[model samples]
Target: MAHTIDISVVPPPLKSDWNPPAPSGNSVSPLVERRLLPAGPAYLAHVKRAVHKLTFEEHDKHVEAENERLGLNGTGANGEDDLGVGDEEEPEDLLTLDAKEWKKQDHYAVLGLSHLRYKATDDQIKIAHRKKVLKHHPDKKAGIAGDSNDDGFFKCIQKAMEVLTNPERRRQFDSVDPHYEDLESEVPTEKQIKNTKDPQFFFKNFAPVFEREARFSRKQPVPMLGAYDASKQEVEGFYDFWYNFDSWRSFEYLDKEINEGSDNRDDKRYTEKKNKSERARRKKEDTARLRGIVDLALAADPRIKRIKQEEKEAREAKKKGKTGAANGLSAKQKEEEEKKKAKEEAKRKEEEDTIARAEAKKAKAAAANAAKKARRAARATEDGTPA
Candidate 1:
C-alpha cells in the first residue's frame, strides 16, 4: 500500500526576514568572516573597498591640524615664526649689479654671507644660495610691479654660487676680497710707525696687522708679533717666519676680463699672458712690501737694541776676564798655556803636512803630464808625424 502525499496542503511560506540561527556565543571575527568568503578577485575587490568616507568638515579639520603641527601658518614648535633663513635685506646697489661684471661683485654679499665672508662654510654657502634663489628667482618676481624682465641680480647670485661652491674658485675670489684689501690699506705705513710717539704703538698697530696677514700664510700656527718685552729669540723668530712666509693668497681674482664671444685663440693667449705677468708683478711687489715691513720692525724694535747692548757688555766682560788671566798666571794656568802652545804646534804641523801633500800631488800630476807628452812625442816621431 503506497502512502498518499498531501500535495494540496503545503507548508506555510517562510518569513522574508528569516535568518539562520546564531552559532554558539559571540559574533564572527573579521579574519574568520573573510576566510568564510569566496576566494578570488571578488574577495580582493571587497577588501580594497573604502570602509568609510570622510565628510568635508572632517577633511578641513585634518588639514588644519597638519598645518598647525608643521608650522606652515607661522609659529612653529620652537615658538618662532617660520620667517625662513637668509631673510636679510639686500642692498639696492647689489640688486642693480650687472651679471657680466660678476668678477667685480662681492660673491659673499650676493649670497647674503657678507658678514661671514671667507669664513662661511660650504654648507652655509649652499643654504645662503638656496635662500637667495627663493627670494630673487625671476619666476618669483614674474608679475611684480616695476620689476622688469631683468634677471641681472639673479644671474649674479648664480655666479656667486658657482664661485663659492667650488673650492678653488672660492679661494680665487677670497684672494682679492675688497674689504680685506681695505683693511690691509689701513695698516700703518713705515712712516706712520716712525712718527708715532705712543709707547704701545707697535703692539697695538702691528699685532693686528700681522694677525690679519697671517690668514694667508700656507703654514698655520703662524708665529705672532709678541709684546714689546719679548725675548731676543722670540723677536728674531717672528721676523724670520714672516721673511720666509709662503702665502697661498693669489691674484687671479684681479685678472682682466677676456673678450667674450671672441673665438680668437690669440686673444685668449694674450689675456692669459697679461694676467700671468700682472700676477708676478704683484707678487714681487708684495714680497718687497713684506720685506720692508720686516726691516722697519727690526729697526724699530727696542729688543734688538737691548740684545746688541747685552752682547757688547758680554764681550767686554769676557775681554776683562782674559786680561785678568793674562796678568797673573797660576801653575794651572801656566800648564793650560803650555797645552795650548802644544795644540797650536800640532795644528801648525798638520797644516804643513797638508800643504806638503798638496805640493806632492801637484808634482805627481806634472810628472804624469810630462810622461804622457813624452810618449805622445815618441809615437809621433815613430809615425813620422809632427811632434
Candidate 2:
C-alpha cells in the first residue's frame, strides 16, 4: 500500500476567552477521563449526533438569514406556513418520492421535450429549463387569489435540468431509455416458446435475443439447439456454452454518477468508489440471472435427451455393421476356395471311374480264357471220356 501523509497545514487556534486546563500526568481511570472531557455530555455516538445537528443547524440558519435579508419572514414567530415567497414545496408524487427515482422518470417527459430528447442540443435544454421555470416559478402566483402550488411539478423540471445539462448523466440515461432499449418488455413468452419448438423456427425467432445478450463472446457463440435429433455431445456442448457464457452486457451505462453536487475531488472519488461497489453488486445479480436461465433450460428442455437416444442407436447400428464386416469372409476369397474344392472332386471321381473299368475288363478276360481252356480240355477229353 502507498503511504499517505497529511500535507494540510493546521491553523493556529484563536486566542479566545475560553481556555481549557491540561490534564494531569496520566494516572486517571477511563471513567474519570471520559467524564472530564470538556465536550459536555459527549460520547463517541454524541459526535455523530453533533455532526447531524451541526449540518441541519447551518442549513436552517442560512434559510433564516436569507429570509430575513429578503424581508420574507413577516410571520416568523407566528408558526404559520409561508405564502410562497421563499418557501419551496416538495410534493409526494410517485416519481418525486425518492431522489434516486429521478433516473426512472422520463426526463424528456419532465421537460416536455419527449420528441427531441436525443436530437436536442445543450442550448435547447437550457432554453427549455428557463421557459419551464418562468411558467412555474412560485413567485408568478403573487396576483392569484388562492395557493398556487402545482404540487412540485417545477422541481421535476429542475431535476430534468440537472440531468440533461450534464453530458455524462444524459448519456447514461439515454442508454437505459425505455423508448430506446425496451429489453425488459421483450422477454420470451410461453406462447412464443411453444410456437418456436421447431429448430429452424426457434432460431429464426429467438437467436437474436441470445445473440444480443451474450453471443458476442470471441470464444464461442452459445446459440439455441432446438432439435430433437441433436447428438449427445451437442447437448453437452450446448449446456457448457450456456453455463460459462461470457456476456458482453455491462452496467457501465447505468452506473451512478460521482458528479452529483460533488464539491471536491475527494468527495467525487468517495462517491465513485461507492458507485463502483454498487455496480459490482448489480453485475453479480445479472450473472446470477443468466445462470438461472441456463439452469431452467437444462432442467425443463426434453430435446437433449431425445437427441442423445437417437445418437446412441445410430452409433450401435454403425458398430454392428463394422463388427459383421470384421468377422465374415470376403466374397472373392470364398468364391476362389469353392472353385478349388470342386476341381479336386471332379479329378478324383474321373480316376475312380477309370480304375473300375480296368478291373471289370480284366475279370471278363480271365473268364473267357477259362471257358476256352475248358472247351479245349473237353475236346481232348472226347477222346479221354468226358471233360
Candidate 3:
C-alpha cells in the first residue's frame, strides 16, 4: 500500500471561473459559460447536466428553507397567519375558474383573503399572491398528477393581482363585493327588529350592520347607532348622519362587458347606455335601502318618546309655576320666565315652519298628479276612448 502515486497524470486544479472543455470529436462547443447558459434550451440543458440534481421532495424542502430565510413563511403584513397548514382546501369551482371571466371571480377568495376581503391591506394581498405563486407555479408543479398546460388558478391569481393592486380597480371591486351582499342579505329585516322582545336586540344586531355600512361613507368618524340609554341628541344625530350619508360606493364593477371583439360604435353606445341605466337603478335602490334603515331606526327609538314625554311634563310644570306664582315672583324669576317663554316661542315657530314645508310638498305632489291625470284623460279623448 506504500506504492508511489503518479502525480503527472492528474489534471491541474480548475480556476474559480473554469468551464468544461467541448468534446474532441464535435466541432461545435456545448460547454457554454455560466453567464451565457440561460440564453437557450441547449445551453440550459448543458448547465443542468453539470449540476447535481435533487429529488422533488428535496427541491420543495430547499424552496421552503429559502422562503423561511427570506421571512416569507410566517405572519403576513396585516398580522394574519400566512396561508399554510390550517387554511381550508380551495373549492373545485375556484380551482376551475375561467380567467377570461375575471369579472365574475372573487378576487379576495382567489388570493386567500376572503376572511379579510376589502379590509385586507395591499401588503397582505402581495404576500398572499407571492405565497400562491411559489406554491402553485407551473414549474414547481411539474410531474405532479393532473397538472396541465391550462393554469386556470394561476391565471386567476394574476388577474386578482392586476385588479387589487390598482386603487381605483380595487375600489370598484370592493363596491360590489359579494361578501358584502351576503352580509346585507343576513341583516335582520325591519319587521324582525320591530317584533323582537329583547330591548338590546336592535343595538346588538343593527350596530354591526351600521358599522359595516359606515366603511362606505365618504365622511369620516361616522356616527354610531348608540345603546338604549343614549341621550336624545345622540340618537337624533345618529339618524341625521345616516339619513344624509354620502357614500363612495358605486356599481361600476357590475357593468356588463361589451361583446368581445365587437367594434361597432352603435353596439358600444348601447352597452354604455345600459350600464349607465343599471348604475342609476342600483344607486337608487341602495339609497332607498339606507333610507328604510334610518326610518326603521327612528320608529324603533325609545328615546324619542321619552324625550317627548319629558318635554310635555316640563311644559305642564312651567304652566303650573306661572299660575301659582302670579304676583309673588322675584325680578330674576320674572326675567327667567320671559326668557323661557321666548325660547319656547322660537321652538314653536320652527316646528310650524317644518309642518308648513311638509304640507307644501304634499300640495305640490297632488298638483303634479292632477296634471298627469288630466293629460291622460285628454289623450284618451283624442283617441276616442273613455275619458
Candidate 4:
C-alpha cells in the first residue's frame, strides 16, 4: 500500500509598501556621476529602503504603546501632544493644553521679521539678536523668571539664531512656520512687494549685508562670469577666475587618479581617466602650496642673518617707540622681518647695479668720441703743411 505524504505550505515574506523618494535632479553632482555610478543605484536604494523600514517599524511600535496608554481606542496617533498618555480618562481640554503650549513656543513667531528682512540685513538682525540675548538670556532672567534650569530655553535661542542665519536652512524653516501659512491671507507689505517683484532692488538692498556677513565668516563670493567684458577695459578679477578654474580642474583630475588605480595602460579611455585623476591631485597640492606661500609672505619671510638684524633693530626701535622689545619681538616675527628686509635689499642692489652699468656706458661713449676727434685732428695736422 502507498503511504500518503502531506506537504506544509510556506508563505513568502511580506514586501515593504514603503518606497524611498527619488534622488533630486540637483542631487547628482558630476563627481558623483563619474566616480559613484559604477557602484549601482540599486545598492544605494536598497540601503535607503532598509533604513526607512526600520524607522517605520519603530514609529509604529511607539504609536501603538502611546494609544493603548491614552485609552484612545481607534484614534490615530498624530504627534500633536508631547504627553501622549494620561493615567486615567483625561478631559479633551487637557489634550488641547499640550498643543497650546507647543504653539506658544513657536520660534518663528517670536522672531516676527520676514525671510527677506533677515536675508537683506543679517548684521542688523545679529545686533538685534545680541540685544535680545542680553534681555531674555535665561541666566540674566533666572532670578525673576523663576526657572533656575534655563538651559533648555537658552538652547532654543541658540537653535533659532543658527537656523535664521543660514539662507537655505532659513528658507526651509520659513516654509514650515505657521506665519508662512498666514502670509497668503495677509496683505503684503510695501517692502515685501518690492522684494518679491524687483530682483535688482532686492539684490542692492541685501547683497551688501549678505557679503559683509560672508566676509566675517571668511567665505569667498560667488563668481559672475557673464558680467565681465574682455573687449572693454582690463578686468581686475580675471586672474582670480582663471586660477579658480585651474585649481578646481587640477584637484578633480588628481582625486580620480588616487581613487581609481591604473590598469589599462594602452586604452584611450584609461589615458583620459589617468589625466583627469592626476590633474585633480596636482591642483590640490598647488592650492595648498599657494596658501603656505601666502602665510610665509605674511610672516615676512626672514633669513637667520636678517632675523638677528631685525631683532637688534626692533630692540632699538622699541626703545624709541616706548614699546617693550621683550614682549613685542617674538623669535618668529624677528626671523620673518629679517628675511623680508634681506629680499628688499637684494632687489634694491640689483636695481642700483643696472643704473651704474647704464651710466658707465654713457661715460665710455663720450670719452671714445673725444679720443676719435683728437686722433683725426692729429692726422690732419700731420698730412697738411699748415700745422
lDDT of 1 by residue, 1-387 (tens): 899877687799999999999778876766643346468955544443433355556655766786676675435346654443344577688789989888888888887777778878777777777778877899887878995534898899899989888999888888788878878666667787778899888778778878878888999899998886788888888998998989888898889889889999999999999999999998888778777777777777767877889889999999999988877667678889999999999999999999999999999999999999999999999999899
RMSD of 3: 33.6
Identify the runs in model 2 with alpha carbons over 4 angstroms from their true place.
Answer: 1-101, 104-244, 252-271, 316-340, 354-387
lDDT of 3 by residue, 1-387 (tens): 699877767788879998888779957868866654257855564555457475556656766786575455465446566644213358788888888889988999988888788888877888788887876677777777974633877899899999999999999999899888888866677789668898778778778889889989999999998776788788778888998999999999999889999989999999999999999999999999888877877777677888888889999999999977875667668899999999999999999999999999999999999999999999999999998
Residue pairs in collision within model 2 = none
Q: Candidate 4 at residue 229, lDDT?
A: 21
Query: Could you tell me how far off, in angstroms, the CA of residue 206 lies in candidate 2 after the best superposition?
Result: 9.3
lDDT of 4 by residue, 1-387 (tens): 999999999998667886778877785546544445435755664565577764656756755787676654322245333221111232333222332233234343333333333343565446444544654466676557542434454454456577678776555444334443353233223446344654344334333322322221222454322221232222224224423433211122122222356465566576677777666565466456444433332232123234457669989987877655554677669899999999999999999999999999999999999999888889889999452
| Model 4 residue-pair collision total | 14
Find the candidate with the highest lDDT and give its number: 3
TM-score of each candidate structure, all chains considered together: 0.59, 0.41, 0.61, 0.20
Ranking by TM-score: 3, 1, 2, 4
Q: What is the lDDT of every predicted structure here?
A: 0.80, 0.65, 0.82, 0.48
Predicted model with the maximum TM-score: 3
Better of 1 and 2 by lDDT: 1
- Give candidate 1 regions above 4 Å deviation: 1-89, 148-150, 312-387
RMSD of 2: 23.3
Worst 10 residues of 2 by lDDT: 81-90
Worst 10 residues of 3 by lDDT: 79-88
- Residue-pair clashes per candidate: 0, 0, 0, 14
What is the descending lDDT order?
A: 3, 1, 2, 4
88-183 per-residue lDDT for model 2 (tens digits): 322345324343466667777666566565667776676566656776776776677864444366677788789888877776666456564555
Any runs in candidate 4 off by more than 4 Å, and if so which?
1-108, 112-120, 144-151, 185-387
